[model samples]
Target: MNSNHLLLEEPIRMASILEPSRPSYFPSMTKIVGTLGPKSRSVEVISRCLMAGMSVARFDFTWGDAEFHQETLENLKLAIKKTKKLCAVMLDTTGPELLVVNKSDQPIPLEADSFVVLTPDQEKEASSNLLPINFSGLAKAVKSGDTIFLGQYLFTGSETTSVWLEVSEVKGDDVVCLIKNSAVLAGTLYTLHVSQVHIDLPTLNDKDKEVISTWGVKNNVDFLSLSHTRSGQDIREAREYLSKLGDLSQTQIFAKIENVEGLVNFDEILQEADGIILARGNLGIDLPPEKVFLFQKAAVYKCNMAGKPAVVTRVVDSMTDNLRPTRAEATDVANAVLDGADAILLGAETMRGLYPVESISIVGKICGESEKVYNQDSYFKKTVKYVGEPMSHMESIASSAVFNFKIT
Candidate 1:
């Protein structure tokens, strides 16, 4: 994070404004989710989002501490009151994950073909250019052909600009990786994802459990989205914990399909969870970029047939910097509506972007427009009716049948 990163100092609320003269924004079957962060954490911005077309406000536990998120939650409650509109608050739990730390106190920009050492310790070995990772068993886990990503970007940042490291040698705990791609490592913590390696870690960390039992239970959050969901057991474990706390029924579980491991176990996870979020950022790192669109189509189609809420994330990523999105980004949101997504989530685009309200309004308009023209009896829906089994990761989008997707 940059020292100059924007943060809201005080709360300033604005009235919920909806002009009847203009065409109404009744979100078509699909919902819109906006992440609550520094840029959009204010009462006015939240009200703007709700008025613009947001149905759910998400509090990401990955970036901020408990205190920070609690404040956001309180503000969201106020926003809900001001708008007097029905909305859900999603407590996004940071499930089993890994973060790459550069302890050198500065940018460690690596050129292409540079060597970096991966260690599983908090040792200050910045002099040796060691990137400290939290989890263990790294050296023996990844092979030479594995790829690594730099950031945990949900949307906006260039996937090609994201740095990737390829393992070339493994020497005990010091696994040496070669930088296959180069970029300026801007922050202290650079998130990493190893290619072809399934991270064997617990579903929930101690902090996650602590939050669920206290703040989550107290707030009765509408949705609990588990990150890096690997299997059905993970969903069951989270539900068990919530049940123990008497919050299981109150909070609907949303499984995030982030990694290859999650995709391998998608059928079971989807069967156990209440909803699905096709988290495209991590999925891009998990699978090839060429296959991401296919996965999105398959995910939305399956969730629709099952009658579960399917959310398409990372739709307007380009809104992070500019007020207007590129043509491709706009098309992505329209296609998500055509794909029959139950919701579309804004990550960095809303969390840290300059045009949070504009992003939501643009996607909302597109969703409404696309829905008007979407055919009810399509070949894809016929194919979906024909096949009872789940589709593959690379399933063709051309035949992905859009089902009756609704948001309540």
Candidate 2:
């Protein structure tokens, strides 16, 4: 027999299939983004995550300082070298978010039907009767009868430990509110949200700009995931800021769709942004829970049609504490892959979860399985139709590539 015939007759070895480094070769086209946190910040954990199919390491600038994140970055670099896998770094900005500052290390108990004073004074200490909000324009933004939610869980689901306060009066820089429910508030920083109130805050706060200019530029960040992106102007402003900082041509801006404003201006946002992140946690808070999935599906389809990457987060939140994911969570992952999501992002699942590596591996497996049933031909036809006739140069090239792929 000829050499080619002899090579084709050789059987693949099982030992090679079970190689330790085999997991590094991701089985699916859908990438995995793992957020770095206390649970997965160590070099060993991060290395395992990379081997389990983490394509990107996300650093949330909202919770950590520059020094803390720099140390985590160093650990990630070490992990990359150890695993010999290329992983991109993403900086998740805080954006125009409102937070509650607590002075006490313990939980402050607020009684039902009690009155509390909300102040914007950062210097003031938080007490059971006094709450300090980070937004300086809190008093101006809210009026009497405005409702404020203070906790992690807002409109997303049932209120667990969240405190409800209704604005009663505005006194100078302080706003007095009546507590509707009794709750114990803990943690140094708590997310604060006002119902139907539009706080006119800058898209990029001073801290966000400082971190991007300093740590982001220093680390050669690959992606900037802007939080609460409202419009295309936000993406442009971020790009301009990065340009002024240093040589960040490689840095891509990903607009996170988390609010009604973001949904309303999504077409323009998608046009300007390099990619889209469907942040369901905050989206659930902004819109009805039933509507959040609709937005996710629509946004993912739009990104696919635009030929841009779309990342879905909070897919398997229950896996944060459990060893295995629920059936619903598994279906969620599969559906996201079938929906043509380019990547699946793990927020609390990988950030503070007990099973970070397991989560990545499970997500990868689901993506690989889902890809088997993906109708590539149909998707391509839809994409071509979305682009229409007289396509641009890049679109024409992409269409040709897909056509060739189908025939081959």
Candidate 3:
């Protein structure tokens, strides 16, 4: 046989003798962000996650201390070396959020219609009748007849454990409330929210500034996901703070939309920040559950038109407990990809979940499959039309290229 014929025949013969090849797996264009917590903080788990297509590793400063995060960051570095894959590190700040402190270190049960005192005393221990909040201005921010929600209301699988308190009186730095429901406060740190009361707290709390200056700057974080981002001013303040703490120009800021204020000021926030994160868990709590999807769609469209990345979180929360995601959860993730999301963030799913690797793999597969039918042509046309007029030099070039490609 001739040399060309021999080369082709040898490959055909080898294929007949060799075992069947496994199906090829392609990575998704959309990024995957996995939260690192107690379950997925080890080097081995993180390596598997990177191989499974986790583009970003998120460290939530709300739960762990500086030392704990330091160790986890070290493990992440080792995992990156082993996998030879690039993964960006994100620091999620606590922002101006409030949490309840239970000094008992155990679950506290409150009876229905029982009287409870909500105090701003950090030194006070949480008792059956007394609950201490982290925010010092809690008493002044709330008035009589206002409703207070401690812990997540629903969808967390811990709704029964959440407590509802109605403010009966505000007396000298103490807000006396009546327990509306008999729920058990299971964790030491429970999120506290007052209904219809605007808590006048600074965008960046002291804890946020300290963490960003110390651990964030020292570690050279790649992204800062600002929590509860209300306005464009919040993004400006965070960028200014980073500028003062050495050269953090490489660190991109992602404003999180989690409340009504954030939704209202999204246009301005988008202009100031590098990206957007739709924190649906808290956003669901802030608005009616049915309205969260509407806001998400609008926000994602705006991000797409602006050519900025939009990340959707809490898409596969049901996977936190089970090995597979629910039908609704699967549809939610697919729809997010179809809606033009640049990334998907798994909070409790990868952080405290039983199957962290499985979660990442499943999400990556969903994103890849969804992209097949993403209707890119329609999306590009809509984006081009929305961005008409007053185009910058770069925008003009990009639009011209796309138009030429479409015609060709």
Q: Which one is best on TM-score?
A: 3
Q: Summarize candidate 3's per-residue lDDT along 1-408 as a digit string, tens digits.
A: 687788775523444435533222578989999999999999999999999999899999888899999999999999999999999999999887888888778888889989999888979888889888888898888778887878743224357778878899988989899998898887676888675466788778899999988899889999999998999999999899898887676789999887888988999999999999999877877787898899989999999989899999988777777899989988999999999999999888888888999999999988887776678779977876887767789988987897899689
| lDDT at 106, model 2 | 72
Worst 10 residues of 2 by lDDT: 152-161
Kindly report which residue pairs in candidate 3 clash with one another. none
Runs of candidate 3 exceeding 4 Å displacement = 1-24, 152-157, 389-408
Among all candidates shown, the one with the greatest lDDT: 3
- Local distance difference test, per candidate? 0.78, 0.85, 0.86
* Candidate 2 vs 3: which has more lDDT: 3
Candidate 1 achieves a global lDDT of 0.78
Task: At residue 50, give the lDDT of candidate 2.
Answer: 93
Number of clashing pairs per prediction, in order = 2, 0, 0
Please write out the lDDT profile of model 2 over residues 1-408, one tens digit for every residue. 797676666554344435443243656789999999989999999999999899999999879789998999999999999989999999999988888888776788899999999888878888889988888889898889987878755211225558879999999999999999998776676888776566798788899988988899899999999998999999999899888877677799999887788899999999999999998877766676788778888999999998899999888877787889899999999999988899999987888788999999999988887776688888978977887888889878977897888789
| TM-score comparison, 1 vs 2, better candidate | 2
TM-score of every candidate = 0.85, 0.87, 0.88
Task: By TM-score, rank the candidates, best first.
Answer: 3, 2, 1
Which scores higher on TM-score, 1 or 3? Answer: 3
Question: Candidate 1 — which pairs collide?
Answer: 380-401, 381-401
